[model samples]
Target: MNKLLSYISLSAIVLLTAGCSDDEPKSEHKGLTGYVIEANYEKKALLVAESDKTAKVGNYDAEWYSLNDDAILHDSKNNTVLLTDIEVGSEVETWSTSRSFESYPSKTDLSKLVVADDVKHPDSPMLQKKAIQAALSHAKSISDTAAILIVQNVTTSKSEWIIQVFNSYSEKSYEFTVNAVTGEVKQIK
Candidate 1:
């Protein structure tokens, strides 16, 4: 009787330990869906706004999310994509760390990013990458040490990119307005 009871207790303990083991598969992490209002390719970060609030209009309340070094990036089809491939105005879902810094635009670390299939402004001729290149090129012509300070899509009746570049040598910032359709860059400031 003692032997049988000891065997039963050992089996129960083993079963309980197995049930609570870390080897169990974890459930998929939940993600937040937002619109990519701004893409800082240089920094590998994005400013995203809640899709429900800023789908078709402004991004006044966007938050900044820096992509982790090991962050998984894929499209809706699950095809792997580079960070530069993500464009502004695209809808994306992100999985991020729990911690975020409190600031004007709260910042967080992103672990995964997926570009949604149903992007609203996919037909735009001038993508954000092209617009940034154009703005940077124009900025370099004026100052060799020019770096992008801000890139914003100012689409109204017509699509436009307002790129702000800072010149370290001159200690001044210049805003360039690039025509999103024609890629014409003009110094607005």
Candidate 2:
């Protein structure tokens, strides 16, 4: 009879412990998916458009998310990448803080950003690489120690890659606008 009671008590304790176990799987929060309309490497921010449906977290609408200092960015293959590796047309999934400011292009603190798909856009690394090479070649004439400051896509009447190179030693700066589609150096100033 004592063994039976002991067995019953042990079973009850086991059941209770198992029910409250911290090892239980928690519900995963799915991140909002969007397309990157613009990526500002200098600001460490991304302007994203909702891929399908409007995404709302709390009272804020998600439009753009600035990368938190600890935010981790990953590519499609799960390889860690920099902001420059994420192109303007790339599809990305982002997890951000619960609260966001109510503004045009509501901003939030990005916790994690993962590239779902990288569509080959004119501003992509492959195209930008050519543009950078051209810009660097021109910058070399001014100063061999010239370094790139900003490389961004600008769309006005025509889409172009704007590369800004600076030579701190000479205090000289050059802005190069390259044809996005053709990867040709269109203008240097």
Candidate 3:
């Protein structure tokens, strides 16, 4: 009877220890810093870019992402912002968990978006798909493994498209900028 009791206790301890394992994956989240290149309150989604000019996360992947209506959005001063308040070119920091980095664009949905009043926004006109079509056409040769790619549009002093590509295996990202009206590929900073 004592041996049986000891065995059961050992089993319980082992199970408890296993449940407390640190090796298990936890919710490791990253904050993505970028600007809101597109905002559609009707759709309750916004495209954010971590790099003002290109997809330059370097060795680290771009952690920035999209924000739906469910996400908590607040201004830099902590004032709450609804989907209708978001504007293009507004500097935004969003929180994201899992992201697909295997393509040129890092596609993700963030939990939160922090917007500041100081972020300048541009009056974006109705989107034209030509630039994105041009970008997607150019990206085919750059990557084939990508399942999701991030796309952002800007219309400030210069109209351009920012395409972010991600590759998880190589940990590589490709970013491109194309003139919106001209559909000409240019060097992205």
Best by TM-score: 1
lDDT of 3 by residue, 1-189 (tens): 999999999999999999999878636365666655455666566666554344464432344355643678798888887777766545667776456466434567767778755522233342434444455456555665643334433433356666554434455556667665556765363
lDDT of each: 0.66, 0.61, 0.57
Q: Candidate 1: misplaced stretches above 4 Å?
A: 1-31, 53-61, 118-189
- Report clash pairs, candidate 1: none
lDDT of model 1 at residue 93? Answer: 82
Cα TM-score of candidate 3: 0.45
Candidate 2 regions with alpha-carbon error over 4 angstroms? 1-31, 53-62, 119-189
Q: Cα deviation of 67 in candidate 1 (Å)?
A: 1.3
- The TM-score that candidate 2 achieves is 0.44
RMSD of 1: 7.8
RMSD of each: 7.8, 11.5, 8.3
lDDT string for model 2 (91-182, tens) is 67888754667774667778888986532344444444455556656556556563322223323224666765444345465677766666
Comparing candidate 1 with candidate 3, which one achieves the higher TM-score?
1
What TM-scores do the predictions have? 0.46, 0.44, 0.45
